[model samples]
Structure formats: structure tokens, C-alpha cells
Target: MSSSLAQKLETRAKSLGFDVVRFTNANLPELTGARLQAFVEAEWHGDMAWMPETLTRRKTPTAMWDGAVSAIVLATNYGPEVDPLERLTNKTTGNISVYALNRDYHDVVKGKLKQLAGWFASQSGQEVKV
Candidate 1:
């Protein structure tokens, strides 16, 4: 990706509430696949059965989609602005986790992702799989 395009994507992602945006080659390392296998074999994911089911595809982006050349990862902080530990001792009022108190982030994020994907396709003149 061009530096200018990367900057634009980063800026747009930030405007859409993404705290962190990064771009990486789609082909993941062998170590990643090995680690994922280890994680699944150890049964550390608990009730998330999808993790093991999708293990083969999750090992690498290319395994899931052959045409994918790059990956844009976005992350946001869902933690509360105030100290959550302080609320542990306060039994008078109910304390809710910051993420749980707000509207479902999935909806918000999906909308933003669509917007971002549209913008990216327009800018890069490339098809966005998502």
C-alpha cells in the first residue's frame, strides 16, 4: 500500500472510533499457525467452539481467501474511562462494565467498517472482499 493511502485509511479509521489501525501482509507466518494449533489443542478457548472449527482458516488470512493481499486490522479500547477497580468496593450502587453499558458495538463497528471499505475501494480502485 502507498504511504498516502495508508495515511488516509488510518485517519479515516481513527475518525470512525478505531483507536488503533495497522496494515500487514496477508500471508501469516508458520509460527502463527503453530501457535493457533497449540492454543486449540490445549482447549484454552473454552466454550468458543468456532475457534477450533475455523482453526485452519484462522491460521492465515490467505487460507480464508486466496485473493487477499493485505489485511487492515482495527482495534478500539472498550474499557471504562474511570477506574473499574474502584467500583468493586462500592456496593451501594450497581456497577456495569463500560462495554456492557453502551449499545452493541458490533452494529456500530460494522457500519463503520462498511464505510471504510467503501472508501478504501474508491481510493485504491480495488475490490474489498468484506
Candidate 2:
């Protein structure tokens, strides 16, 4: 069952031009989650309410949602031709986080996630009405 699902996922990913695909458990690592929760409790994430919500989810992804099978962490490298830090010297203008200066990544990455979800549903024979 796992082999066929993996094969189908790979094939669908290739068709959608994905570089790689992998599966993960819903439950995050215990030590990592505990440390994250501790960090949140310490108020290290000042002014970020999302951090607490993330901590709650990290405590256990499975508890957050039923039938949650995997978590996809995707990153794209927009290689800077020159030193991005050089721009910081000219403090006259605003210096956005290097990545946010450009296009919205959620738009770019969500399409890939949608494609993967489609393939997974199809391969698994699960009715993905969503």
C-alpha cells in the first residue's frame, strides 16, 4: 500500500515538476515540541500571537485536526546575485525582509501544494471534494 502510494505521488509530482516529495507523521518530535512550547511560555515571541498558535499545533498536529496525514514544508531559494546586506547601509529607505521584497510566496507555493494534494487524493482513492 505504501509503495504504490509513494510511486503515484512521485509520478504525479514529476508531472507537476516538483523536485521531491516525502511523508511525515502528524505528531511532531516530543523534545522539539516541548522546547518550542517552553520558548512560547517564556514570551520569547514578543508581539506574535501566531507563535502561540503554532506552539499549540506543534505540541501535536494530530490533535489539531482529524485525519491529518502529512505536513509539507517547502522552501524556495531566490538566490541574490549580490550581497543583500549591502542594501542595509542605505537606511534611508525601508528594508523589507529579503524575501518579502519580491512576489508573495504563498501564491507561488500554494499551487504546488494544491497539485500534490490532488495527486495524493487521486492515488489514495479518497474523495477530495475540497
Candidate 3:
């Protein structure tokens, strides 16, 4: 198979602070798409109405937005000073999402992304938006 867009983006994305990078074709392969279809057909989404409503978009991100040439999914260290995973085992209290252990990542990550995208925009003339 040909190298994926992620692979092509990896070299530059790594320079942008990604320690690890991988690429899959934006187009879903039949086998994987069939698996996703099976999951939906089996009613696994339950109360997640949006999951069903956006099934096609989730399966193919291009449907979510036009001219969606790339998906730069960034993973970062949102953990606390300690091994936060330990807290989840207690079950004595409510279980929090691992990523939500700290401040709301949406605000933090989006702010940081805007900053970086701002810098990129300064360098290039593209208008940046989420």
C-alpha cells in the first residue's frame, strides 16, 4: 500500500513536537468500515444519539467538512505530576476520564493550538480556524 497522509505529515508534525505519528488513509477500507457499520447496527451507541446521527461523518471525516485534506490529531501529556491512573482504580469515588484528570483540555488544548496556528498564520497567509 501507499504511504498514508499521516506518514507524509509525520516528518513535519514531529518537528512540531509529536514524539509519535501514524497515518491511515482518510478513505475507510471496506473491512474497517464494515466493522463500524456492525457496531452501529448492533445498537452499541445507546444514548449517544449524536453517534448515530454522525455515523457517516465519523466513518469519513471528509463528510464532516469539505476540503478536509488532513487530520492532525495531536496527543499530549495531560497527566498530572503523579501517576493519575492509580486514582481510577479506587472506585471509591467517581471515575474521571483519564484526559479530564486536570483542567478542561478543550480550553487548554484549543488555546495552545490557536497560539501555534497563529504562529503558522504569521509565517503563512492562510486564515486559521477550527
The candidate that achieves the highest TM-score relative to the unseen native structure: 1
Cα-based TM-score, every candidate: 0.86, 0.64, 0.54
Candidate 2, 21: how far from true, in Å? Answer: 2.6
The reply for model 2, stretches above 4 Å from the true place, is: 14-20, 67-75, 78-97, 127-130
The sequence of per-residue lDDT tens digits that candidate 1 reaches over residues 27-111 is: 8889989999999999999999999999988998787888888899999876667788898898899878767877788887788
lDDT of 1: 0.88
Q: Which residue pairs collide, candidate 2?
A: none
- Reference-based lDDT, residue 40, model 1: 94
Taking all chains together, the TM-score of candidate 3 against the true structure is: 0.54
- What lDDT would candidate 2 get against the real structure? 0.70
lDDT tens digits, residue span 1-130, model 3: 2254335445554555545554444566677767887899899978888877878877776777766665546566665667767877887798766666667977876776666566545655555454
Give the Cα error of residue 109 in candidate 2, in Å.
Answer: 1.6
Candidate 1 local lDDT, residue 59: 94
